[model samples]
Structure formats: C-alpha cells, structure tokens
Target chain A: EIADAAEALLGAGGVKVGGALRGRHVLVTSGPTHEPIDPVRYIANRSSGKQGHAIAAAAAAAGARVTLVSGPVNLPDPAGIAVHHVETARDMLAAVEAALPADAAVFAAAVADWRVAAEAGQKLKKDGNALAPLALTENPDILAGIARRAEGRPRLVVGFAAETQNVVAHAQAKLARKGCDWIVANDVSRDGGHQSGIPGGVMGADSNAVHLVSAAGVEHWPTASKAEIAQRLVARIAVALGPQESQS
Target chain B: EIADAAEALLGAGGVKVGGALRGRHVLVTSGPTHEPIDPVRYIANRSSGKQGHAIAAAAAAAGARVTLVSGPVNLPDPAGIAVHHVETARDMLAAVEAALPADAAVFAAAVADWRVAAEAGQKLKKDGNALAPLALTENPDILAGIARRAEGRPRLVVGFAAETQNVVAHAQAKLARKGCDWIVANDVSRDGGHQSGIPGGVMGADSNAVHLVSAAGVEHWPTASKAEIAQRLVARIAVALGPQESQS
Candidate 1:
C-alpha cells in the first residue's frame, strides 16, 4: 500500500506535500573510526553515535530509505532503516561504495585522519626517555571521495566543517575542496559550547545554534533543540525536493 | 606571577607555542532562540548547546577571556568563563551587542530565522476546520551584525553553516552574506547522523568528523570527540590570530 501510494505520488506530482522523499535513497555514515597504533593503543575519537542514530531515525520518519554505514558505537539500530556496521575508516568507505547509486549521501562519521603506518602486534612498553615516534599517514576523505565520484554518484553529497575560528571562511574553502552539495559548518571550539570532552558519550546538554548555507544563500537559524533542528531541516529538504510550483 | 611569565613570553616571542591567545577577548553565542507563537507554543529548534558550550570551554582553556552569550537551555556554566542568558533571538542579539568589543566573535547559536510578527497574548482556540495562518518576519543575522559592525567591531567574526544539501555552495554564499571571517559547515540532515531525539542534551557522545575550510583550502579532519576537535580548532585559532599571518 505504501509503495502504491508512493507510485501514485510520483506518477502525478504537481506539488508533493505529504511525501516528498518517498522514493529517495539516502546514505549516511556514523560513529568513530579506529586507527590502530599498536595492539592496545589506537587512535580514535569520542562518538557515541547519538547524533548519527537520531539522524537515521529522523530520515526514516521522513519517508526516506536510509542505509546507515556506521563505525564502532554502542547505539541501537534505528527502526525502519538498514544498518551496515564497520570498524575503521577504510571499511566505512567500502560500505559506502557498496551502497552506491543513492540519491543523497551524508558523510557524518568521525573518521580518523591519520593512522599509524606500522601496527605493532604487541603493545609497546613505555621507553624511559628515547621513545620512538610513531610514523603516520593521512586517511582517505570519505566526503571528498563520494563527492568526487565519477560513476553512480549521489546527486547530493554533503560534508561537515567542525571549526573554531573563521567558521564561514573555512566552510567556504571546504565547499570547494570536497565538492559536496552542502557543508554543515560548526565551531567545535571548547569555548563555544560544543563537544570538548571524550567521545562515545552523550550530547546536547544545552540548546544549539546553526546556519544553513546553500546556493540560494545563507539562512541563519536561531538557537533551539537538536530535535527541533531536525524537524526544520527535514521540512527544508521536503521543500527542496518539492516541485517548482511549491517553491514559490 | 602568571601574568609576568606571559609578558616575558611575549617579550621573548616564545608565547606562540600554546599560550598564543593569552590576553585575547572572545565572544561566543550558543543555544536556540525561541520565537513565540503564543504563551504556550513557540518556534524553536533541537539544539543541545553541546557544540557551543564546548567551544566556550575550549576557548577559555586556550587563554582567551571568553564571554558566552546563550539562549535558554539547561546546562552548567563552564569554569573561567562569563555567561549571559537570554530567551528569544532578539534578546540574544542584544546580549551579543552588550558583550561586544572583543578581539573575536563566534556566532554558534542556532537562532530562529523567523518570528511571529506579533504575539497573541491569548492562545487561540481550535474550534473548527478554519485556522488562523501565522505571519512570520525575518530575524536579524547576529553574526552578520557583528561582522558588519562599524565601531568597536571584533577583529575576527565566525559563523556556522548547518546544511543538508549543497553544503559548500551554501557556505560560500554565507561567507558573503554574513561577511564573517569563516564559516563552519556541517551536514545535519536526517541521514547525516548528527541529530539526537532528545530535546536538549550533550554528553557521553562518541567521535565527530569535521572539515576546516578557509581561503587557502579545505582541511578535513577525521572523526574524533568534540573535545579533540575543539583543541585542534583552538590551536588553529592561535595560528590565525598570530602576528602577520596571511589573510585568507
């Protein structure tokens, strides 16, 4: 019945109101990727997958078929969404590749930027003074990877800019670098009320503030709850996917 | 004694390590602003204030005397930071104005884009099929306000972009619209995995992934906790705020 309704909506679409994203496929990445430094010591970030989990749930609620390629996190799978779990950034990228031909892709996972070039099977003991420096290398940028895809690329590829100072300037540069459809720029500076502690913890102790930057222009939204922000953002997406008549 | 050491470090040109921001003044805004629909119903967003609050704490830790102007939300104030509370977007703007004349400003608050033109003191009754249409007006862009300030303007002004689609394109436009030094862009769409159902909470979350965009180029960071992101951002700010740096 839902499929039939979606087909009907798509067949005669003048201005879709009830179901804007009935046939869209959305790809999202979540949680933290672990980069192994040694047997015990690994590079990772603090992410509990709360934000990513909530985003998947919200997308499902908005009638989108979501494929959430997640990193290692202990959050229950959101109902009505397909889940693909991975551990490292490379695995997450592969999972994203498997879920290709999506209508939209959201690179939300906190991937490790660098990984130890050599992984010691055994944990290294602390040296007295002359400790060997661990050589590192850059990791693949999943957002850029998807954004720069030549085949089966999603129509909309989004990136995130977690900055401290000159937030807008950084976001502008990222827009060009990643070639994504949009960038959600945020100041993660400890002094700006962002996450400043360990990962894999809870979040949203206070309210939030954000700006929406797009080709149309920059629209600033005042402070509110993350849930409220999601609803407003979903509504905006609905409009963006709406027919020409509905836009005006 | 610490002040004298700081002066000595400045004199010796060795303060650039971690104490580069020793005496800078920073103004930050966080949380959601409410737009009253009635006494009971108001327009708002889902923001936990985690990101903003974290930024404030990080900036303070980085040696900046920070002033946090926030909208209504439940969260303990960070140590060594001055906080001002407000309710509506208008009030937040006023608070920001009152706390001005700082070296830098970060508009991280998720302000409402529109507000009811006039508040109806009494809640309207839902009697029948007929309902009153709400009339909304655009709110002021607080970041833009500070960026365009003529007198006692902050040397650096940063804004945020929370987008779902066309992220980079939108961020670039926002850079122009807000006239800010930088914009931090992120994708917070439902499938972006950065939204939580909880109204306003921020803690115990895992890693975060973000990009740093600037005139020079985009630098993408792998996912980590909000704290790590804050630390890196503060370090970047120290470099940006250093002497005779090229303006991007």
Candidate 2:
C-alpha cells in the first residue's frame, strides 16, 4: 500500500507525532541460531535475545505492524507483534523469506557463520579421548541476500555488527559487505575498556553502547538501557521511513 | 530441622500429596552455559531453560524453598523462589557453590564441557583465511563436585544425562561417576527412533520423555510437558525425603 510514503518522505528525520510507523510493516530478527552437530546438541552463540526483542517492541510501540523472527529463547512473545519461532540458521532464513515484502527489516540475530557440514542423526559417542571432528560449512548470508535482492526488497534494511576491537571499523566494512542501509555496531568485549562503572558490552546485560553507522557517517551513542537504545533506533527508522498513511 | 526425614525414607518412591516438600530446601540449575572464544563471540549449547525453570516451579509448588541458579535466559523469575543468574560454566559453578546447604539439588543445566583456555581480551579479528584456533580446557563438573563434596553436600543430589544412545546405560554410568543419588536421563537425539507420531527427544521442545535412574533402578516415564515432568520429579524427591517435622 506504500503506506505513509508521502508524509514519511516529507517529514524531517525525527519522531513524528502521527504514529510515525503507523500502517507500515516492519520485519525484525533476534536471538542466536543453532547449527546442529547432532540431533540433540547444536553449536550456538551466546545471544539472550534481549536487544532484538526490545527493538521489536519499540517498533511496535511506534505503530508499526512488526513481524519478529526469533531463534530459540525463553522469552514470551512480545505483545502486538507477529512472532515466528525457529531454531537453525536455515529455519531463520526460510522464516525471514516468508515474512518479507516489508517497509523495513532489522537483522539483529547472531546467526552462526558456519554449521556442521553434515549432522549426525545419532549422538556422536565420546569414544576415547579424541571426540569426533565436526566438518564445517558456511551458512547463507541473510543480510547480504536480503539487501541485494533484485525485487521486493525492503525500503530500508538495518544490520547489527557486534564486534569487540575495531567496532566502528568492522561495522563500516559490514555495511559495505552486507549491502545493508544502516549498521548498528556495538562492542561486546568485557575487558572493561569503556568508561569505568558503565557496563558496556556482554550478552544479557541490561545496557548498551551503540553506534548508528550509515553512508551519512557514524553516530556514536552513550551507554543506555537496551530499551532506551531500541526506542531511539526506532525513532531514527521512523524519521527515515516517514509517518504512516491513514488506517483502512 | 530433620523435616520429612522419616516418611521420605520409608515411602515407595513416588509422588505423594499433602505438601510433602513443605519447609524443605531445594536448589536447581537450568539453561546452557556460554564458553567465551573472544570478548564478543562464544561457544554455547541450544538450551531454552524451559525444563530447568519448570523443575524449579514444580518444587516451589510442592511447598519447597527453591533456589534456582540459572544461566542467561529471558524467563521471568519464578514466584516464591530465589534466583541466581550466571553466564559461563565457571560462573555457574561459583553460583552453585555459593548456593549450597540444601536438602536436595538438581543439576539440569547444560554446562559446557570445555571453554576456550584463555579468552581474547579484545575482539578476535577475522583476518585472512583462517581465524585463530580455539584452545579448550575442561570446565568444572558442577554436579560431580557437589555430589562428591567432603561436607555439607545436599542429601539427595540429582544430575541430568542428556544422551543420544544407550540413554539408560549412560545415565547409570553418570550416576556412578558423578556420585549423585539420582540421574534424570533422557534421549536428546532426533532420529525419530521413538514411537511414531510422537515428537520426542530434542532440546527447545515444550514436552519431554525422561528416565529417572536411581540406585533402586530406572523408571521410564511417558512423554509429557516439561512442567509435568518437573512435577513428577519433585514428587519423587518429596517421597524420597519423607514428611517434614512440625515447623517452629
């Protein structure tokens, strides 16, 4: 319906009063994907799904019709969002593909870059000291695939770069490599290099320090609650996408 | 307070009514522990903490004072219980150590068997073709540690055996190796080898099929919700612990 295409285009980059994201469809992904080693055991990242869930909630609060694709997490489904639960990276890709054709998409999931090339139907035995070696294979680059879509691509796509050392540098490279319009980069190291007393990085932590990277340049933000970061990010997205048209 | 010590010792080892666990103290661990590779990335298992949380809830419902030491999960704290959140297996071990002195303890967490010997203080770069190799070291065996404690160990310690093949045999071996009183063994393989039409044996599923392997023998249970399994387990524990003496 190209909902709010005009108002959004005209409004300056900021939170608009008239339900900035009203009538717009937004897709978001959160949590960590499990790449199976065997049916019972899987390799995974340490993502608690908090930040992505918060972002989905913020987008919904901003009046967007949100579709949240989540990996295995203990969290309850967020109110006012269509949630698709999945386990593996392939499942997440399929779910994302199915939920597409939206105004915007957010890729916040920590999908494993690789999966066991061939999973064992049965559990591998501990047979002696040397465990069975797992063969690796690359998973689909979901962000790049979506960004480089020839048709039906989202108007705006945001990807996250959770790096420790060269946070901004890696995020910049990821923006180019992944072909996404915006990158939300954050340092997730726990060496306490940031301002003392502020818990900057690490998963499941309530707070974050993020940078909004785009062709316009990098906008570093102060350490804040994950909920607050989500709100501000949603605000930026609303400003870029503009306000929604009247509801049917 | 030798609560329920007599009846528990004499009961036929099953669920009994009348708040059999009243005034009893029980401790439990749930979820998968993360082993850091670098500051930002980690190796982890695909555990949703559902079973562990359900067990904690069930114990509380049976009138026991429960202390749940959990790894990173998004679940709301269970009512009427104390919760200690942790991240890594080491952190989990520490938390469990600090939460000792209970009538019983349940080790339901998927503790990592190995951790990167040394964590990268800074973000490890994805340089060139090969990423840095992850040198792993053995993690502390929380269940075995508590089970074989020199003093003040819980009287009825329980451990979980998430195995794929020879589930009962492996569980029996673990019971002996870990020196725990009981072992809740379950097949986590996904080969669909179980009775047809039933979804069984895997992580992240809402339901479970488990075997309670104790010194007495193995008790095979029907497939049931995680909550139901927790309830039945607590019942057995109560019966094992017997009836409590009158409170002060």
Candidate 3:
C-alpha cells in the first residue's frame, strides 16, 4: 500500500497528478434507502454504507473528483467529495442522474427493490385486528437505468450483488441483466461462502470477501477490510481506464 | 440540574445515598425493533433511542441498578448499567421478562406493532414484476404484557406513545389500555404539535416536548432536551415510589 502511494506520487506530472485516477470524475452511491410506510414507520435494506463510503473516500484520495449520493447512514461524509444525502430509491436515482457524465459510476447502495404502493398519510392504527397486507410497487432499477443510458453514459458502470446463495452465478446474471460493465458480488448469509466470522456478517462488518465478475471472467478477492477492498477497486478502476491519452 | 445533583449528593447516608432511586432496580426498553421481511429487508419505526437511553443513564445516576433492553441503535451503552441488545420485539420481550421483579419498568422502545407473517430465509428476488402485498401479523405488546402481569408487577410501569396526531388523547387511551402507570407521549409529526424544528423531527432529534399521561390526568411538559425530560421523569418516579422506608 505504501509503495503504491509512493508510485502514484511520482508517476503523474501533467493535468493528472498523484494517483492514477487524477483528473477523472467518479460517481458512487452508498447506504440503504428508507421507503417510508407512514409518518413514523418505514421499510429498508440492511446496510451500514461502510463499503460505499470507503470507496468514495478511496476515490477522493486517488485525486479524482468524486460525487457520492448516499442514503441515511451513521457515517460522516468523506472529505473533499460532493455528497447528496437521500432517503428513498426514487430520490437516489434523481440525485445520481443529476451528477452524471462521469468517467465511472459505482452503484453500491442496497436500494429497496420495492416500496409501499400506497404510503399512509397518517400512522395506521392497530385496532386489535390483523393489518391488510401492504401492497408494493417496484422501485426503479438504478443500475440498469444508468447502464442503459442512450446518451452521456459513463465509460464504466459497476453494480453490486449481495446474495446468500449462488453468489457468482447470481452476480453474472445481474451484470448481464443490468447491462453494467462489472458486478461486485459477495455472500451476505450468516453462514456459507465469504464468512467474515463476525456476528452480523458482511452487511455491517468492517471486513469483506468479494468476487469481481466481468465480461472477461471472475476474480475472487481474499478476505480484507472494507477499506482495503475499496482501495483495490479504485486501483482496478484506474487500470481499466488506461493511460492519460485514453483518458482524454 | 446542578442544584438537583448537589441536593442528591448532600441527602441520604445509607443504601439510599446520592439519589432517591438508590438500591432500587429499574428496567428500561429503548430503540426500534426490526421485523424482518426477508434475510435482507425489514420494517422498522424511526427511533434514535436517545430518550430511552437518557432515561437509563439518569436512573443509573440516581443510584439505581438499571437493566436496559435495547433494540438496534447507534448509541453506546450507558455506563454502570446492564444492557441487553436485541433486534426484534419478541427478543426484546424475552430479555425484558428475564430482568423482571423490578421497582419500575419503562417501555420506551418504538416496537413494531406488526411483523411480516412469513419471513423469507433467503433474499427475495426482483423478477421484473410488482411484488405481492406483504402479510403482517401482530407483534407482542411488551408494555401491555408487563403492565398486566399478575405476579411480580413493578410498582411503577411507564409506556411511551409516539403519535402523529391527538397526542395527549392517544397517550391517555394508551395508558388505560396498556394498564401502565404512566405514558410519556410525544408528537412525532413533520409539522405542528411539539415541532422540534429539526429536519427529521423528534424521532432522532436532541430535544422533545412531552405529556405525562396517567389516571391522575395529563401534565404538559414544555419542549426540552431529551436528557432533561429523562431526569424529570426519573425524579417523578423517585417521588412516586416514596421514601426508602417502603424499601423493605
């Protein structure tokens, strides 16, 4: 890590300086969107936003101009990045679209796939009876929307797959379905693949093990801190973007 | 507050030294219970656990042996208190039941009234279609369950009501229905009635306005910091329980 930092310091001299991603614009999304059921209740995905925030921080450290659209999380905003805090999937999509035309975009948020079709204007009363089943509507597919952009599409679009079973296979399917350039997949089950040995598993754990699935093939990353995984991902992004000539 | 602390210090010389609740056991429940829809998704009430945690801290400061049963919250456990962390309302109820026969019990948790009837073991897939309405079953009413206890009932049982409208009315009804001694009720709406003027309102805010509802009637408390409200509540509890002569 020290060597990489030192090399990045000495390697670039022009408009691009410091890290390989210098002079590039990278957009990232983090945390879990909260879909409100009423004034005091909501539905949400379980996410700490650790990995996504780390990625944004790493990108910023790499000297890239970073725009981070985050959901409600306990984490502080990463330094030197444009951050937009949002609550629901619809709001997140709007924010991401507004910060567009980036070199690369990483969709790391555990956005709800569906939200309450009819959110209550007031708190629903419990009258000693069973509540009617809550109807749900599909939330916009943010990854697919950005990846399938007809105009001003980012050069690289990345998505994340948090699965309990068939991690790689599911990730591959998601990558193809979303039309994203790559998919970062991880097992989030309490047991089985990529176990962090932590009580809550990778969802909120500091460490993670992931598989990078792309058109070329699959690459299994060793268990490491979420920060380390983020740094590695940023480094890979820099490589994929290639030389300064191609960057222009 | 400083004068009160000093008075506590100067008063009492035996087992009741420092504060009125000395040598007493107080049980508190805080935060919002999460009811899982699947391995990854869940429904929850919006709560910061600040008020409940503050009450626990205040009780401990009053020299009480505090047993706090907390749901998922970002706050640290109060010093010199027995804290049991739980996720779902059922687990919270079990933990609370285990730490019973207390002098007082405070149900400050914004427990879910209902939970998904069928919790999926695996992540539910998004198969390019609208998802069916989620069936929900009623969760155990921890406050009512404890308040209605025939044996080992606490001398003082307090419940909290987070309402969007008809704050005092709802609280009064809740006190009678739950059979709890008192109800600390607050308005949690975005606008009007006890508005904290904060972005997220009273749920996660530092300050709050509450009404203490009991069979004795309602006592309106002005908007104050949650800590202040806690201290005031604890003081009332101490007074209600009366001098240590009733200790044995």
The lDDT for every candidate, in the order shown, is 0.64, 0.79, 0.86
- All candidates: TM-score of chain A: 0.81, 0.88, 0.89
For residue B24, model 1's alpha carbon misses the true position, in angstroms, by: 0.7
Off by over 4 Å in 1: A1-248, B1-18, B128-130, B194-207, B243-248
Write candidate 2's Cα lDDT for B146-243 as tens digits.
Answer: 99999989989999988877889999999998899999988876552343432234566778888989888888877878887887788778867866
Candidate rank order under TM-score: 3, 2, 1
Q: Please give, for residues A145-221, the per-residue lDDT of candidate 1 as tens digits.
A: 98998888898786655554566776777788778877765544445444444111123233445665555455556
In candidate 2, how many clashes are counted?
4
**lDDT against true structure, model 1:** 0.64
Question: Per-prediction fnat values?
Answer: 0.00, 0.36, 0.87
Query: Comparing 1 and 2 by lDDT, which wins?
Result: 2
TM-score for the first chain in candidate 1 comes to: 0.81
Q: Ten-residue segment with the worst summed lDDT in candidate 3 chain A? A: A9-18
Which residue window of length 10 is worst by lDDT in model 2 chain B? Answer: B1-10
> In order, what DockQ does each candidate have?
0.01, 0.32, 0.66
Error of 3 at B121 (Å): 0.5
